[model samples]
Target: MADDTGNLELEAFRAEARAWLEANFPPALKGKGGLAMAEITFQDADLATWRRAIGEKGWATPTWPKEYGGGGLSRAQARVLQQEMGRIGAFNPLMFGMGVTMIGPTILDYGTEAQKQQHIPPIVRGEVQWCVGYSEPNAGSDLASLQMRCEDAGDHWQINGSKIWTSGAQYSDWCGALVRTDPTAKKHDGISFILIDMHQPAIETRPIKLIAGASPFCETFFTDATAPKDAILGELNRGWTVGKRLLQHERASQTGDRGPGGGGSAVALADLAKRYAGADAAGRIADPDLRTRVIRQQMDAKVHGLTLARAAAEAKEGASNAASVLKNSATHVAQTRAELMLEIMGHQGLGWDGEDFTREELEAVRGWLSGKAMSIYGGSFEIQNNIISKRILGLPDSTGST
Candidate 1:
């Protein structure tokens, strides 16, 4: 049942959104979405056109504030826009960046007015790429142990040390990094979150090749890489709190609750199984066990979606730490799909590159390899469970215990 005026206005908005998408989004990219991180060829005319169109329209960050070049839509309106885009198979080109997923949100939460004016517009425009510099060679999972020094240098802060597993560091224009600012303070207390330009001479990036065909990960070194004195995000030596918030944003992005489709694939799982593994006499999947697993995964994905929607409805502003729950669920669903896709594709999935395997199959294998890291990234599965146990479950902390 639909109300007269409100329903009509919503319908009108949807129609307008659909028309804009149809006019602007390239036909080739409709179902394909934005280029996958590894496959991003920024020079492609179609991609460039689509990215520019959405960025300028401010639809790239639909729920963000308009002053920062965001779409200025309410949460409901943003959801509608996403639905309209999804209806047409259109994908947001700018959603892939750390800027969109992590940095920008943190900036909005804690940045000074001047900082927002300087950074948010470019981010909203998709004009820059950002990498997170959180993991150091020594820090890794124990991020608070980071030793990247940021020294006071009057006009700028001199940074020194290295970050490992920095995704997109080589291609990034900027980095939102966690650095140690005060050695005398507590491990988590003395840290600061800073924004550093990646194009400077003091910063260097080396790509780290993975077992997967493409490498988005990098080793980023800072030898006196400087951030402007005012570039420290949040209060000086209070980055641990800021960093945690950023992680929440990161987890939220991974859970797919914020944007279109909850990051789920357009192609249904059963369809893939039927296509690759073939069907039985009754037109059901031939493999009984695989069919069961696929059904369960589908159900789990649905449950995860419902839970996310519920969480969204409950939270008036910021999300709860329960994003960690969704993150773990998403990891499970994705890894399960990868495993099933490989099984269904069988030998076709094994080839890295050849005439024998379809592009989709090759991608599946690579995606499987890449998806394996999802558990490790955005806080590992174990870490998320720990969060769930303590934060969500109210379990006792086992620190300094056997």
Candidate 2:
């Protein structure tokens, strides 16, 4: 049943990957994927170097077409790369950028040849960052009810409106935004997805501070943000389809398909429990009740990981109804991990700031706070349930709405 030649070749490739990763991955940044999640700017030499190395090697966007500067690894080869990186406690620093997760894949799907040539390479190279402008003040879950005006200005398009909860807008170089191009048309029909340049003065971003301290979420305003006439993604008024497709991509990223598991440099919950709460004679968590709950949470996390792997194996591309199911599952695993961690730390985890708390303790408090949004963003928990009922369960849409 085994392909000997193929197995031999794969093993050879694995060796090459291990060597390359050893040569390139910075030891100081090992298991630091949490830093990548929080990083909006590159200031550290090691971080910058790691980004450059991966970008040049095209491993940052591995499996994307090589013509666009991606590694163009086969799906199997990509998994091998992931395993190698995990072994070294190396993670893709580029995961912080929305360019790879939402925008780049959407562009590949909906963009023209010229658009791909111009945009995809820079994204793959980690030379640019992107944000999505979807949720307006009034259009949070009801995204179709957007009111941003995108006027055809002969030579270019002018965008005038605000997008709330625009994550990373303050740092993004570009934005893929939806705008009302035909006000007279129906709500969904009038919307067109456009690629906007964020460097212009017409665009302003105000970061929304969170309970966890500084965050990427921002309130973005466009007084008269301009884009090229050719900046429209897909057909002009058919952007709802493109927008929905991008949402699928966003869900996929949250499903744990990307990162190597070794990052975050985090202490295992059990280890933390033993250290902070004291270990029993049997080397188990001292408290019986807390020990049972921690074991349950870890089981749930493992089940979630396996389910993700199954969903990935079933289909490597396209939007599947499984996304809704797994998206919620991912939120559960992440949030539960944070909660269990906080509980394990007990009173010490409550520290917002002080010399009394360890760095991990302070971060755990923030992480727990920030993890609350996991249920809401990327289409909320309730939204995913509705999707599952309709798409996966063959239930009717009772809300009589999109």
Candidate 3:
């Protein structure tokens, strides 16, 4: 059966994927139940099975070249793969961290043949977890002013300073980070984008507990952490270009506009409305005024999804900067949906803790809080506005800075 599935042509791949998923993926991991279930943890066997299947088909990183351990599938085939995965309600096995999200794409764009050969396969296979080390205590919004230094030592660079808000750093095996390679140069001029081994003695990570009690972000410190001279991702003193490209990919991923089962938010929202307010609840969803708002939000979510698809198509057609607008717009729409979901719940939404809080309420609160950071993290809302104003709109550069 596996061999037959493997031999499937483009048309047959979707059918095979659907059949395989039906047979292999548990019902609990399928459809609305799979997403609504509060637990974020995945069983090792389940993860392994899904990863092996996606990895074999290169559906994990579908558009990447075959030589660098990708599925070498056409964009059309990749879309089919996504549709099949969505039909089965199979969650993305690579959605956990930066390995698949940021680093993998960055390496594909800027990495040498050697680097691509070394890095891409493991990441696609889920053998490695990577994290971003872009933010520092004082250097988040104004990222170029970062003070983390990397000193040349003939064959290696000794790194020092701290990175704050390093997501999943404690569990990450590698970090694609920015460090100051030349202190005398201007803020952004001398920065170097380098890959750092997270298991080294000089690295220390302390998780920062959030208001929700779980800490997904960490403070990472480096004390003379050594990286091989070849760890540089792009040109030595021209890392700003590489960093910007990586940021573009990160922003695109955060838009939640790609991959299989991507429309979970809309489905979740519909489920919440029906379960909480009922099918014909007055002034809830059936009420004319409230119904208008609900319908508008649903339309907006659909528009956002379609816009993302257009942007992806544009990217594949050589419009590289299309992601910027799609990302900014998608984040705004998602935040709006989160707000509406809470509004639909009304009184029940107010509760943050305790068993009295329904799963919907808990999710709403966490999502609302997290949505606040969506505008800030992958370049702030302000930053995106500036990009649109200057680059897309051809506005005058009043600030004289990027």
lDDT for each residue of candidate 1 in 1-402, tens digit (9 for 90 to 100): 457877788788888888888898888776675263433544677878877888999998998999999999878778898897788777877777899889999999999999999999999998898999999888988999999999999888999999999999888999999999999998889999999999899999999999886778999889988889999999999999999999999998888665742223567778888998989999889899999998988898789889989988888766588789999998988898889888888888898988888877777888899889998998999999999999899999998567
Model 3 agreement with the true structure over 231-296: per-residue lDDT tens digits: 999899888889998888787787764566543533556556666666673425554565677778
Q: Rank the candidates by lDDT, best first.
A: 2, 1, 3
Task: State the number of backbone clashes in model 2.
Answer: 0
Which pairs clash in model 3?
none
Candidate topping TM-score: 2
Candidate 3 stretches greater than 4 Å from native: 1-10, 32-45, 263-268, 281-284, 316-319, 353-360, 400-402
Candidates in order have lDDT scores of 0.86, 0.88, 0.77
Can you write out model 2's per-residue Cα lDDT over 1-402, one digit (the tens) per residue?
A: 379887887889899999999998999988778877765654678888888999999998888999999998887788888999988789998876789999999999999999999999999888998999999999999999999999999899989999999999988999999899999999889889999989999999999999788767999999988999999999999999999999998998887677433366456888988988898999999999989988998899899989988887888555688889999998998888898898888899899988999988888898899889989999999999999998899999897877
Residue runs of model 1 more than 4 Å from their true location after superposition:
1-4, 34-36, 39-42, 261-265, 400-402
Q: In lDDT terms, which candidate is top?
A: 2
Clashing pairs counted in every model? 0, 0, 0
Which 10 residues in a row give candidate 3 its minimum summed lDDT?
32-41
- Tell me the TM-score of model 1: 0.95
